[model samples]
Target chain A: MNIVENFDLYAPRLINKKELLSAGHRACQGCGEVLAVRLMCKALGENTVIASATGCMEIISSMYPTTAWEVPWIHVAFENAAAVAAGVEAGLKGLRKKGKIDDRYIKVVGMAGDGGTMDIGLQALSGAMERGHDMLFVCFDNEAYMNTGIQRSSGTPMGASTTTAPAGKISSGQKTWKKNMAEIMVAHSVPYVATACPSYPLDFIRKVEKAKATKGPSYIHCFSVCPTGWRCGSHLAIAMGRLAVESGVFPLYEVENGKYKVSSEMPKKLKPVKDYFKGQGRFRHLGEAEIQVIQHKVESEYQKILDKVKYLKAWD
Target chain B: MAKRVGMEVAVAVAEAVGQCDIDMAAVYPITPQSHIAEHLSDLVADGKIDAEFVTVESEHSAMSAVIGASGTGARVYTATSSQGLMLMHELLPIASGMRLPIVMGIANRAVSGPLNILNDHSDIMPQRDSGWISLFVENGQEAIDLSIQAFKIAEHKDVLLPVCVNIDGFQLTHMVEPLEFPDQELVNKFLPPRVPYATLHPSKPVTMGAFAMSDYFTEMMKAKDEALKNSKKVIIDIWDEWARMFGRAYKPVETYKAEDAEILMLTMGSMGETAEVAIDALRAKGVSAGLIKLRLWRPFPFEEIRAAAKNAKKLIVTDRAVSFGGPGGPVFSEIKSALYHEAHRPAIYNYIIGLGGRDVTVKDFIGMVEKVIPYNAEKTVDTYEFWGVRE
Candidate 1:
């Protein structure tokens, strides 16, 4: 049995080099979401079926008569990727049990953007997880409805300017904090729940591989930097994702069976949230007062994870 | 061997569905629709059916899950009604456009305003343009028969469109009736295992439901429309084969005592039976009242509709759902549109009846026909009215 073993970040050669999401696609330059999708697909490989929600990845990867998907992929609609994946998993099981198909281990994957996951898609995702379907749901968190021209979504971070929630003299950007989707999946008591960033390529790949091996529902919330929507330099997309994790605004962590583990080693003193927001034009209007408020929230949330890690530590 | 058994219409419908050798079902429980889902769940639990029964959170997910399962080359099924159907409205087009052969049972109920959960066609009426093969069953026997045939019709290569077998909520679905269950071996022989045109498999990768811009959007819609239009022949073919194997026969626009009648009353769903009784009473009263039961709602059955109304001088179109501010009731408008170009067409009067499950007895049907009796081809009358509304 050729099973993907525990991955080592130091050994790049150990990773599967197959490009399941092929080239000739129309994603923007330095689009971190597409990069994350590409990396996750590499981890999933040929023995997988992806049920993608209608969002940026779906549009860019699949246009009629031409497709970047080298693997079997279905784009159903927004808000139902999890439900669809659950169905796919169940369908495969049914077919295999009926002896209509061989019992080869084909992973069922559901992929969606933040808006598709945290907001409109939440119920389906929750239902799928609760049902314990053998599938993996990945949320590419660009923090807004980027595919619909940077509209504010529940996933949009507080004070982040979007087309719908523009920062003005009379008003701040988005009024809500970024929804903790990975934590929400954990609440569903799924076997595996993780937060990853493609900038940490090894970590992202490893988590996906772990999800692939999982027998029940698994969810991964990926921090996908959007250069175009965020009004940041295209080149800073990867750096932006790394900054998101390092600044404690978005942490690299995993929860296994109700136990939490912070994947990345946090600095003794976390970088100020302003440092994470500095490069992006979306947060350019934020003054010290607003930044301080966001900074406080980030620190407290990050500390909550640390507290969970300290007390609930069970796995290595 | 087939034997008659007394069962609730909903339970029998689920049993009929189970016999289809379906691989998966994702259903949500809603009023008038809960029995189908519950019974199907029991069937799966009891090992009566080898299928995955996903009790979805909402009807939206139910439709989505079925679409996904069907895309994986599995014979999939689902059930919903009224508000549930309304909730599932968005994914309806997606399912048909993707051409997934999924069969669903809809215990028809009125869409809410005052939140009524009784029998009505308001639920399935608005889904007219969803590109699905829609069929209305008049009774328990038809519900069971049609539910089984749905899989065969939907999975047909020519018609890889989703099929919704609509049975009136409470009126038909909740009724206990003696219905014959076809032998499992015979059902398997009649409705062969689904042969999916394309599927999500590792060996053969395909991208379905791709983004289509203006350059290709119209063409994609045209293809879907053409596919639905072409599906009529396959539907008839399957029904014919079903009739040959079993003893029951069905038609898109079925008529009852309409021969040489001047006045024809049109009805859909379980109301057709009542309308028949009304026709008998009207004939006894020396009125030339007849009945036309529209069994197939989608792909509209235009030719059959026109042919059925040809000999009639006046057509009384009864609609259970209000089109609200539009041209009378939905079915009434459809009937008018279907007969618009014909040089010698009947004068059609639309009666919007049974909104939110108001009882439409035989007397009501007789009254509707009698009200339309005063009109003739030469003189114009009110095109439509809310039948039974207080003046």
Candidate 2:
């Protein structure tokens, strides 16, 4: 394994201690999305320009006169972050080729939330990836539209209550499965596609580093836990992410050059999905039958990744 | 030395953009605007121009990509028409508000209920409030000249705003005419490399397009408005410089045979030439008919409009797009609003004509003047009518 893959051993020495996203602006207490952004920025370092979509991260970090971004950043609109990043990449390349600017390799990154990515921004992202711009798009999937007060998004998990898909006398909350954005990006045939969570910072940082080194398009789907949106205690945010990965609800994996490799170690007997849903109020309305349905879906999804890793030959 | 060549207006506009030494262009193909995009793609593919040509999937992405490129301090260009322009409407204000100097070519076409891909000002009429510096061109030569001048006007330090050069679709964009191509050396001398006010650079970190709330929203809007209003001076200065360099003069409002006329007609875009021909015919027949061509639409050219119409007893304004339930024509409404407070305002009449590529002949212009000659502004029940509409 490379040094970044084995970064947990030499993290203090290998990591750049400089923080790109500054401290103390307006992120909620224990906001997993902001935490994931912090780790990703640390891996990106100073040689990066970010195009951020209007979301929780953009709102918290940039508020008129103040800003928390230590590197270059821009927020164009809600659904065009990927398209903007592609423009930045092309602009830089054009400038360098004409000797207008220095030929330093600057990584362009697109950042958005679940609603911006899986829903409104999907077309722009697909076009950018297909065109093969050297950029990274990181979707901070907090399940629902946390920025808009717990509205249901395509990334929202089934049976999870939201403002638009609330559990009532007749409704059982979100009816659809969480969109598999990682697989959707993988289907674009990009150079790198990965799933990560702030619950495992080293693993998440390692994936970001790999994506940064990627020549063409790279996508990272971050499973960010929203304590406020999920109607859970803020202190349990990290713990909830841990529970999610351990219960196989959100598997950690990476697809490099069409080859699948599971990043996290799976238990011989995976933890039950009920354990992941116990503290979250969004899933509290579900009965045993609903829990069983979720549990079955989680097991099968995790098995699909495992099976792909086992069956697919390594591209290298 | 400038050289005159016969070429299609759309291709000439693209070639003019190439002469500006742009850094990037992001365009999506649409009717009447596809030729510009095609030629630009070929220019980049054949290495004729040292630029990046981004073939975006939709007009929204095309506008968004150019915004991003301009934010990164790249000299950028793009083209679209009608439905494509409507798709780009959301980002137009954002581009102007951020003060990104992106220059775009608009092939003015009719918007659809029944889908017509032809010449009209309906495409650009709805974007009046988009905060862009809008310029209308009459023919192929003006199309090429304005396409080159748009970059210089947009990138001026005092006027760092997006500009749209509107050419009538199929009327001017598809027509072949002899156009004078400005020399590269002169264009380079006129338009230097862009020095962006603020750019996304790791060396100097800055935040662009930040969220503005009630505390600062009004102030931000005020800044944008002031910038657009102040751009008129810079626009005139650039036009003066172009005239001195190329011997082809342009103005916010151009007049033809209006010096000693009692009756004047106003027009925009390609219809200006037809109206001028009509004026010549009226003058030969001993009628005091004149023409006022409005080249600048965004700033409204209030002073120029008043100056041109101050001596005339009656002014007929022809519009190619209807303003729906509000007013008869969008241009007529604007001119009425502009002349409302003027002390020496002429009696203005509106004629909504040439909609959806309905050909406006020279005789049609003559007919409008004759139709409105007998009516008095205060006594007439309806001062505006849809001309040439089948009864």
Candidate of highest lDDT:
2
Give me candidate 2's TM-score against the actual structure: 0.98
Q: After superposition, how far is residue B230 of candidate 2 from its true place, in Å?
A: 0.8
**Candidate 2 residue lDDT tens string, A18-122:** 889999769999899999999999999998999999999999999989999999999999999999998988888888888877778899999999999999999
For each candidate, the DockQ is 0.79, 0.80
lDDT of 1 by residue, B1-391 (tens): 4878999999999989989999999999998989999999999999999998888888999999998888889999999999999999999999999999889899999888889988888899889999999999999999989999998888888888999999999999999999999878889899888899998889899998899899999998999999999988998988898888898999898999998889999999999998998899999999987999999998889999999999999998989988778878899888999999999888888888888878889989988888877766666464688888998
Identify the leading candidate in terms of DockQ. Answer: 2
**Clash pairs (backbone) in predicted model 2:** none
DockQ-derived CAPRI band for the predicted complex in model 2: high
Return the clash pairs for model 1, or none.
none
Give me candidate 1's TM-score against the actual structure.
0.97
Scanning candidate 1 chain B in windows of ten residues, the lowest lDDT window is B374-383
What does the lDDT come to for candidate 2? 0.91
The DockQ score of candidate 1 comes to 0.79
